[model samples]
Target: MLTTILNLLEVAAWSGIAALGFGILFNIPKSVIFTVFMLGFTAGLIKFSLMYFNVHIVLATFIAVFFVGIICMPVAHKIHHPPVVFCIPPTIPMIPGYFAYETVLSVMNFIFMEDDQAKRVELIDTIFTNGFTMIFILISIAAGISLPMLLLRKDSVKKIEE
Candidate 1:
């Protein structure tokens, strides 16, 4: 129990730092830095917690990004900046870097290896698996982030036009 809590905290802290760094890189307003950190922390916590309970990574990421999008809407309204500013930085931490890296590595290996049928088949399997997983995770993140904005567009547009 204690270990799980500590792990969650560690993930949260690191994710917050990553998000803050991206926010700085993006040149977001100084006042919004803390909010970005909190958003990142929340995203990490939600994603990690779901994964800890044995949820699939793709679904976990989608849920986490969706919640972040939902949460950022109100924060954006209060801060008077677009919700995307908050929504994007937090999601940087959730990107499946390992899967992407492995996909690329597998592809390179597949291309360079000699004509060993069994070895080639194995490499092809690895390439497809990792590549598909990475692609789905990215798709989910996009859907999760955009769904909230699309759903709330009417109200957001009305407010902006006023």
Candidate 2:
């Protein structure tokens, strides 16, 4: 129990830091950096918590990004910035970097390995698996961020214009 909590905290803390760094890199307003951190923390907590309980990574990422979008709407209005400013940074922390790296590594191995059919087959499987997982996770993140904005377009746009 304690270990799970600690793990979640660690993930959240690192996620927040990553988001804050991205926010800084993006040149977002100084006032919004803390909000970005909190959003990242919430996103990491939600995604990893779901994964810990056996949820698929793609679905977990979608749900987490969706919640971040919903939460960012009001904050965007208050800050007079688009919700995307808040949404993008938080979602950055959830990107499947490991899967992408593995995909590349597998491809390299496939290219270098001798004509051992068994190893070739395994490498092909690994490449497709990691590549597909990474692609789907990215798609889910895009959908998650876009869905809320599409659903709340009127309100979000109107509020920003006000």
Candidate 3:
């Protein structure tokens, strides 16, 4: 129970930091929820494989997804005209930095190991896991954010036509 509580606290702190950083980077001032959601997503990405704390993963993911939805609101406003035109600010905070780092470290280990084939193989496997996981996360997050907006826009258009 104590460990779970600590992890929740950690997730909150990290999420806040991430959201603030992203908001500042993108010049979006006074975005409290944005900061929280971005940070929460990062936390979810980090704890994806933890078997003991699956609940945290779900909560963090929903929180992050909610913020991502909020962020997309303004994006939808800007790209309201040309559906193909999408504007992404620099500090969106969707990229998973830790996963990238892990991937790089794994690859480096594989390359630097002189004689341990097993270690190299293990590192290689981890590298693939990290890379694919990041890719999957990115695709899923994008889709998760985009799909709703797209559906709404389409429905609005249809309503107008009708």
Candidate 4:
């Protein structure tokens, strides 16, 4: 139990670091850095919490992204920055890099599956598994993040200096 709490904290911390790096790379303003970091941290916490409760990974990601989107509306309004600016950089940490890499690696292995039927089956199964997982995850992330903005009618906010 205690270990679970620690693990969540660790995920949040590492995710925040990744978010900050992405935000910096994307040229997110300095004032918005902390907000982006917290959003990313919150996303990690939400996903981990859902997974801890035995929710599916894709569902957890969808829920986290949707919640983050809902939260970002008020934040965008309050901070006077475009929701896209705030909403996107934070979600970068959640991209399933491992799955994407696995998808590609499995494809490569499948291509080289010379006469070994077991290896061919294994590689093909892996390719399909990782490929579909990546696709659905990306779809959920985009849809979840976009849902709130679709409902909101406000124009994009311009960056204001503090």
**Between candidates 2 and 4, which one is better according to TM-score?**
2
Global lDDT of model 3:
0.52
- Tens-digit lDDT string for candidate 4 (107-157): 877776446998788888888899898889899999998886566653443
- Each prediction's RMSD over C-alphas, in Å, is 2.3, 2.0, 6.5, 3.3
Put down candidate 1 lDDT per residue, 32-131, tens digits, no spaces.
8889999999999999999999999999999999999788767876777777677799999888899999998888888885478898899889989999
Worst 10 residues of 4 by lDDT: 153-162
Give the TM-scores of the predictions, in the order they appear: 0.91, 0.93, 0.59, 0.90
Off by over 4 Å in 2: 153-156, 160-162
| Candidate 2 lDDT score at position 1 | 100
Of 3 and 4, the candidate ranking higher by TM-score? 4
Candidate 4 runs further than 4 Å off: 153-162
- Measured by TM-score, the strongest candidate is 2
Ranking of predictions according to TM-score:
2, 1, 4, 3
**lDDT, model 2:** 0.87
Query: In order, what lDDT does every prediction score?
Result: 0.87, 0.87, 0.52, 0.84
- Residue 20, model 4: lDDT of 85
The local lDDT score (0 to 100) that residue 147 gets in candidate 4 is 81
